[model samples]
Target: MQHKHGISPRMEHYSCMVTLLGRAGKLDDAYDIINQMPFEPDGCIWGSLLGSCRVHGNVVLAEPENASNYVLLSNIYAYKKMWDGVNRLRDMMKTVGLKKEKGCSWIEIKNKVHMLLAGDSSNPMMAAITEKQ
Candidate 1:
């Protein structure tokens, strides 16, 4: 597209390619694309690769300051029943004095935003939402 169509590769295009390649287990290629990007990889780009890593059970690291990445990686290991990985990750965190941050998410509904936190079932619609799922 860049050479033939004279179109420049944008972040979104790179993100899509990374998602596709990573999901297909072409992790190396996906990473290569990220490294070749004209700009620094953003959260979405890294998130795509991390998600693929989770699916394929491949251990990978993301932003060092983002505790969520470590938690997600640890959870992936737990899902795969890899006790050693989970233990090692926890031990590493302890050694580094890194604490897991509580997960929080927000959704917009009718132009109003609602926030929910992990392990907190205080949302008014929690019961209905849980039932629907």
Candidate 2:
């Protein structure tokens, strides 16, 4: 359709196609799109591919073939319970000095938001929140 209309496909459009292909178990086609895209594939694109690989147990592109896409791709694999993928990603991270960013959360209350970090439980009612959960 894009070629028919002489319209250049946007990054988002390409990403969406990749996502759809992944969802449909057309991982080979998804990988082809990533490899053939005119623009560089971003983390989202690689992440989508990684997710498909995990679901299908296809390790063709499971390795960090492209370093730039490693971070998100590794994460997607990890989320899918691929320990080997996680280890590979960790090794790549060590090689590139890329530490996983520590997770943090923000809570919005009364038009004001409070940021909470992993170990910094500065919330006044931390005990109450834990009890409820």
Candidate 3:
């Protein structure tokens, strides 16, 4: 696409390339590309690698030593329905003193906005919601 459009590669370009290559199971290639980057790789780059690792069911790349990567790995594992991986990530976070933020959601009904927080029982429909779920 770049060649056809006469566009030059940039950080965004490299990031997308790394993500695609990692998703395709070319981890070494992705890692090489990341290493070649002039600046330090950030959380986004690590997230791409960790997501790909989870998709491929390869936990080796999700080691807890890399905290940022571990967070992404945990999210990916959660999406992939891997309870064990999620639990491992939770444990790692606890051990490292990384507090996992509580999840929250908001909904609007009859022009009124309702908010829900993890473990909060303030909602009037809390009983119904819990029963349904």
Candidate 4:
């Protein structure tokens, strides 16, 4: 698009390109495109690569600080029932002093806001909530 129409490519376009190349097993080429992007890539870009890596059994992560990246990889390993990989990632996090913070959600009802943390069962209405779900 840039060369033919003078229009810069957006993140979504790059994402699609990466996904396409990744699905075709052109991981290196997909990574090359990410590197060439003028703007810094966000989670979506890395996510595209990570997904391809999972499918291809290759882990190529350029980011180190984001906890979410680790979580994503861990989730992939868990999905595949690769217990060893999951444990290794957990150990790596401990060694690196990285902790995955608990995720939370906020909901408002009757003008009152309530915060709920992931895996939290302290709420008195937890049983009802689970039953509702």
RMSD per model, one decimal: 4.6, 6.8, 8.1, 6.3
| lDDT tens per residue, model 4, 1-133 | 8999998899999999999998898989999999999899887788788878777766555233467668768776787788897898888898888887787777665676667789998976556555653
Note the residue pairs that clash in candidate 4.
none
User: Model 3 Cα displacement at 14 (Å)?
Assistant: 1.2
lDDT of 2 by residue, 1-133 (tens): 6769988898898899998999899998988998899989886787678767767766666655455346556665666787897787779778878665555777765677777778877787555445653
Best by TM-score: 1
Off by over 4 Å in 4: 60-65, 75-84, 94-133
Summarize candidate 3's per-residue lDDT along 36-85 as a digit string, tens digits. Answer: 98788776777787778777766666544356666767877787788998
The lDDT, on a scale of 0 to 1, for candidate 4 is 0.78
Model 1 score (lDDT)? 0.81
Task: Answer with 2 or 3, whichever has the higher lDDT.
Answer: 3
Comparison by lDDT, 1 against 4, better one:
1
Question: Could you tell me the lDDT of residue 104 within candidate 2?
Answer: 71
- Top model number, lDDT: 1
lDDT of 2: 0.74
- Models 1 onward score TM values of 0.64, 0.56, 0.55, 0.59
> Candidate 3 overall Cα lDDT vs. reference?
0.76
Residue 53 lDDT in candidate 1: 82
lDDT, candidate 1, 32-121, per-residue tens: 999999999887788788888888877754333345566768878898898898898888888888887676788765677778789999
